[model samples]
Target: METFAEVLIILVVLTNLKLLGSSRATACIRTVAAQGVLLAALPLVTSGDAITLRMIAQALVSGTLKAFVLPFLLLRATRGARAGRELAPFVGYTTSILLGVALMPLALALGRKLGVTGPAGADLLAPAALFTLLVGLLIIVCRKQAVTLVVGYLAMENGIYAMGLAFAQREPLLVEMGILLDVFAAVFVMGLVARHIHREFDTLDTDRLSSLKG
Candidate 1:
């Protein structure tokens, strides 16, 4: 089980890097969708004797929203905006990957110091969760486009959700539901803003949104 979670975490992190480096908006969106699906599967893969009805419900809701609904919304937004090329990254692709590599050790050290325990068979979840969180933060900081930024945000949220599954003893269904609702609302607003950006600037590049500079 630990190995499974580790594999999923690695896949998630790789997808984050792909999103950061890819020039095609469509490709980035697809990678985000894939990350969502992998995250959704984590619960089932790590389930042990402690599994409960509430946990299952939480996982279902999370998987449905993060994996299916959120991606569907983003895909629609991408199609509507007709965003093609990725804008210039604040940090280049190679630099971002290097930074990610540098950050991994810090994440591992933090997880080790914290010594978070997961299910009986799944002990590696802590370090993987920490790494995913760090990667998500890097994506948010380095990507300029609104869609890409949202993807980063979602990645971060997924990391948190993964941690909750790994560590939280009790299922916080209400909190989980609230977070999903907030994410949905945020995605709706972002889609509107993306449409407006395309309408006003003729591009989705964040660098190009500085027309009001003093």
Candidate 2:
């Protein structure tokens, strides 16, 4: 179980780097979906030998949304908006990747300093969660398009979900349902706004919004 958790955490870390380095919006969306699938498996490994029905429900619901529903929403939004690559970010792609690489050591050190570990099998979740949060923040600040920002928001949301896994045994199923509902609402709203923005502005670049008079 410990080894499973470690491998899962490492894969999550790799997805973070992939998100930072990827330019094609479709590729980024797929990578985030992959991360969702990995995280959905997280509870099973961390549950040790006494896995519950509730955990299975949570993983199934979470995986369906993260891997399929959310990505499909984003893809539909992208098609509606005619969105493409993340061009003209405030920070360049190369720099973003370099920064992502640099953040790993810092996250690992901070994770250790905090001395927090996930229950039993999930010792490496802390650093991986932190890395994901930082990468999401980086994408949020550096990228210019509304679609990319939505992607970043999802990544940050995933990070928070991962942190919650440290206390998975104690969290109620109701709270998990609430989190999923909130996430779905947020993405739905963001997708609508992005499509509208493109309809009016002819581009998804959020920097174009400053030209609006009202």
Index of the highest-TM-score prediction: 2
Model 2: lDDT equals 0.86
Q: Which stretches of candidate 1 lie over 4 Å from their true place?
A: 80-82, 211-214
lDDT per residue (tens digit) for residues 1-214 in model 1: 6677678767876776676667776687678778877877777777755677766776677677876788777767676565776657888778888888887788778877777777655565676677777777887888777777777777787777667766856455676678789988998788778767767777676777776966
Worst 10 residues of 1 by lDDT: 164-173
Q: What is the C-alpha lDDT of each candidate?
A: 0.74, 0.86
Worst window of 10 by summed lDDT in candidate 2: 164-173
Number of the top-ranking candidate, with lDDT as the measure: 2
Report the Cα lDDT for candidate 1.
0.74
lDDT score, candidate 1, position 168: 50
TM-score of 2: 0.94
Error of 2 at 178 (Å): 0.8
RMSD of each: 2.2, 1.7
TM-score of every model versus the real structure:
0.87, 0.94
lDDT of 2 at 140: 96
